[model samples]
Target: MQQCSYCVNFTPAFQIIAMTKPATLKEIARRLNVSVSTVSRALHDHPSIGLRTRTQVHQLAQELNYEPNKTAIFFKQGKTFTIGVILPNLSEEFFSMAITGIEQTALKHSYNVLMGQSHDLPELEKRITATMKDHRVDGLIISLAKDSKDFEHFNQLDKYNIPVVFFDRIPPQKTAHYVSCNLRPGISQAVQFLIKKGHKRIALINGPSSLLATKERMEGYTAALHAKKIKIDMGLVVSTDLSTGGTEDAMKQLLALKNPPTAIITFNDYVALDAIRYARRHNKKINQDLSFVSCANLPITHYLDTPPLASVEQFPREQGEKAMEIMLQLLTRGEELKQKGQFFQTELESRLELIEP
Candidate 1:
């Protein structure tokens, strides 16, 4: 009546015990009184395998704790069933949520994800891409670094017959398919909210000048200002790299101006949070002394001591899913997959309330 150490929940000693070899498919097939091919087809969920027989084979394998050798499967199929994911940084909650969506979709399709971070450096980004290529990944998903102005790093993927897809912070040249929020309507909505509050002088804290999102958002800000018959005040807008230090510098510059803006729009919620912190240093109450709005409306922004006057919530999860769907099709199909490559866009603008007054 002796039970195995694992079954008895014993803290077994590694030196005293021998490691048990994993059960193989052949052993399970023998136990089930079935051919090896039949067991494999059943394990793979082959449509040809009868449901009743498949259930019996699966139950037998479970009893044996059978595990298929993935290496053998990969060798036979000539596919690693792995995808590489490159992001500027994973600390940001926005990228984390987007990654969650990508992981979910990749798992459902029985593919593995290889992750890499660029840390917003161009040379590092190139190195990561090269490493992923060396791994012979089946596909790649990327959100380019702030300094990645050239697409040559990703060009290697094409040379290796690997598909690359972009999302959120995409490359400068849209040579491949990408999925991201349309920033125009979101920025327009945020600016209009400030105008509705009777604030004529508005300022923008944008991301790096090289980013496509920054350019698009600036355009939206300019268009909104023109529509309201307000001349674009070049001094009011401060283009800074998206960072805490950058945001603080921008806020200080605006506060120093003799004619400071009554409202400010930021590249993202994180930037707005930094602005709020800066405003507190100067004894300026947010939404009272100055109205604030930002893009990428993450939940953390809402929990701040002083939340933004409004925010724009883009569908990052959907963007991730759409990017994967396109990459999958392109890898499996050919030029026919181009239909799915069409940009998938969504928008969500916060309903501004007079939180201050």
Candidate 2:
């Protein structure tokens, strides 16, 4: 009769066990024959709590899989302990490296990071900014999209006293903290290196004319050519949306010129790759018939059989680290402690490397 009764109670017993919730602080206190306040102070490592009690509390908490209620803590501290990052393209090597730096720095400070990609679209950039604001992130780090002309979306964050730091593709704002690379020197060095390799007719496969990097890079190219007493040919400069097909189109147009360039400088590695493909199709040998150089020396370039002759390193990771550092300082030391419109630039020459042919 008892054996039959055991089977009859099995289903109900399982149901009761399934309904039991996770262990709580009160439950721990009851088990240890102590007051709830005592358990709380012990878990918090309060100075008044005895060392033995704190150790016991920590051990039991771990055993019970206890986790503090972050929502409740947010209410008490008025901070979400989270930072939001908005980038143009997550697939790009530059942004990916930058994210690693930002995440590492954030975790070291016990803060969480939330990321959003705009895919280089203006409207999506606005939506991403709005979503980050809605989540009540303590701060924001952003690299403006290729077509992000309006910055009104960021003004809402200012209304809430939230600080913002820009990195890489920064906007034209005069009152924002920024971390960037000095493009002029890097571009100049790249061009001069190509010239030294005995390539005089140099073409530039640039990105959208609106980008600040594009402007700076163009300045560098022009300056380098001027230093060498070479005439600036507008025909050699082709502006594209930086799409694969756009890059191919730019390459085709350059190669069709009456006197095509013997060397080329691209905006980034992606453009450089497209140029390589185009050159191969036209029976041109990279680093031989046509010297190549570009920015954002992505890791993949090192593994390629025919890598660029040289790549200008932008130090994306350093940019991210600096941006986070500035953000944390603003958060802890207050906005007044930082000068308005303050900007930091990572070292350019250290990042540039000449790939052996």
Candidate 3:
């Protein structure tokens, strides 16, 4: 029984791979005749690990092509060094910009991002969150699903000792950590700008009542109108699901009023585009028969021939970076910071950006 040349050559190579398939910490420990923890400490050059032991471990590690498993290394420290990010829709320019900021900031701290898009569905948002929880992500950053109101999924993270930071679409209840844009200032500014332009009948096409942003828009509208001695008109206000059809319906509602508004303030540029298109479809002259102002200041709006007269710059990317920074602080500054009741919230003021349109 003579063995084939191929079999003889493959046997040793296959055995070598079998021995180091994973090249785990336990394997290294067994080889060095040391405890797993001891080998881990020596690899990290901890002071408790003697210099000779550390040196030998390093030399052996280099010779054996032993790469430290980051998962094991982080597990001992009770961290995954990975954060989860959930967004309403990754296709939106605003959220895409936010992702860029979050990823860049996470990279600076040697962390990885696990991203999920909820597509504005509440159930999808909950599922994504649960999946991330199953993965044991150290922290989570979310721009909530537009339709989500229960918030129980967000609340459950607290029970599991996971820190979550919200940005853009913050919950009305301020119990958890968040970074958000205060839409009042910018909305008021937009209202005043419209008033200055001699548009007395201003309409508000806001989002669903579940959102803090919708409430802020209503507040700013009334506040600005009050400041200018104009009576607030409930008939001029309408709510939208923020879909193209929903925005169109809101525009129709406002336009149907006997005292139709000469100007409209929409939730965001996306909504404004839809509203403007709806008006155009009805033969209304944009910025003339129906002037428009919106929020989000999305970059895609710049390419539109008739963008909003002005938009509120929410600084999505800055908000994202700030949110990530907060998550890092909560994670790195001990568990007490991310405990049951303590919270860190930062709100940036939205600025009304005047556009050529």
Candidate 4:
């Protein structure tokens, strides 16, 4: 017998083609000699269905790899059983931790999540939001991008009766459901700690001025300075896009002053890391010549040879979990409940540790 050129064994093409199609409820019913409705009810564990019959249906479904039609389910329930999450940057440790909480909570509620990263671009964020709408997600969880100014994209979701829950970097909308950490106490404490250590000239390397978190942190910084009777120095505070290069530029500018700040506070760990590198290259030692503090106490800080003076624990994971919980409530509850809107303010304890060289 002549062997086929593609393979040594002669496998029939029809067999390969047959395996590609997925098993369906109708197929299961046909095989089990039951009605399609009976199979569906049994799979759903409907109370009307007999226990033995349900068990038989489940066994046959496992054997045939039968999967329910989600489209039909959606039609019946008026929900997609899916949630959409939009983040500024997926690579950021804060967002990464938040995603874990969001995903875990979503899974517990039998809902799937679809994630989109905007990379801090307004246009891209709009596009991603549109895509989420097209996917017909039941609800949304969002952290606004750094440069996001236009919120009209979200209006479409509102028009379609989709609930939105904001976390971390939320938008300016007052009526929206959101979860955020109260940054004032931690930031104020950090500044107070620095002042207690006799550091009068302090510089702030902040994220975009448009961001809510940045605004809050700046307010906290200024309040602390005012409390200590120190005049607010506008020149000492630098705003950046929070990119590595942006942070490095801000550090350079601060270091070039005739009387530069003895201490620096940054937006997040990545910005702090960049500032530290820049300071070291310019002959400044961490915790010696220059004291540094930042937000988002990432795990890497603990492992660093020379960690920052302190890092404000923002509890990204908890923020994510709370946002998910809020979203779930909005989805499960009626439209009237969603319209009421809820805001969760998480006041995580601030952790401050001064590193000694």
lDDT of each: 0.81, 0.86, 0.89, 0.86
Better of 3 and 4 by TM-score: 4
Cα lDDT of model 1 by residue, 1-357, tens digit: 998868655545553344445568788778778888998999888999999889998887777667789888787886889999998889988888888889899999988899999999989988988999888788899888986788877876777888888888776564567787778777887788888889999999989977878888888889988888889999999977888898899998999999999899988878888888899889997889988988777877767667887787777777778778877877788455545554323222223232321
- The true-versus-predicted C-alpha distance at residue 171 of model 1, in Å, is 2.0
Residue pairs with clashing backbones, model 2:
none
Q: List the residue pairs that clash in candidate 4.
A: none
Local accuracy of candidate 2 as per-residue lDDT tens digits, 222-265: 99999999999999999779888898899989999999999999
Best by TM-score: 4
Model 1 gets an lDDT of: 0.81
TM-score of model 3 (CA atoms): 0.87
Query: At residue 224, what lDDT does model 2 achieve?
Result: 94
lDDT of 3 at 285: 93
User: How would the candidate models be sorted by TM-score, starting from the highest?
Assistant: 4, 3, 2, 1
Error of 3 at 26 (Å): 5.8
- lDDT of model 3 at position 31: 89
Clashes of each: 0, 0, 0, 0
Off by over 4 Å in 4: 10-22, 28-34, 42-63, 338-357
The candidate, 3 or 4, that scores higher on lDDT is: 3
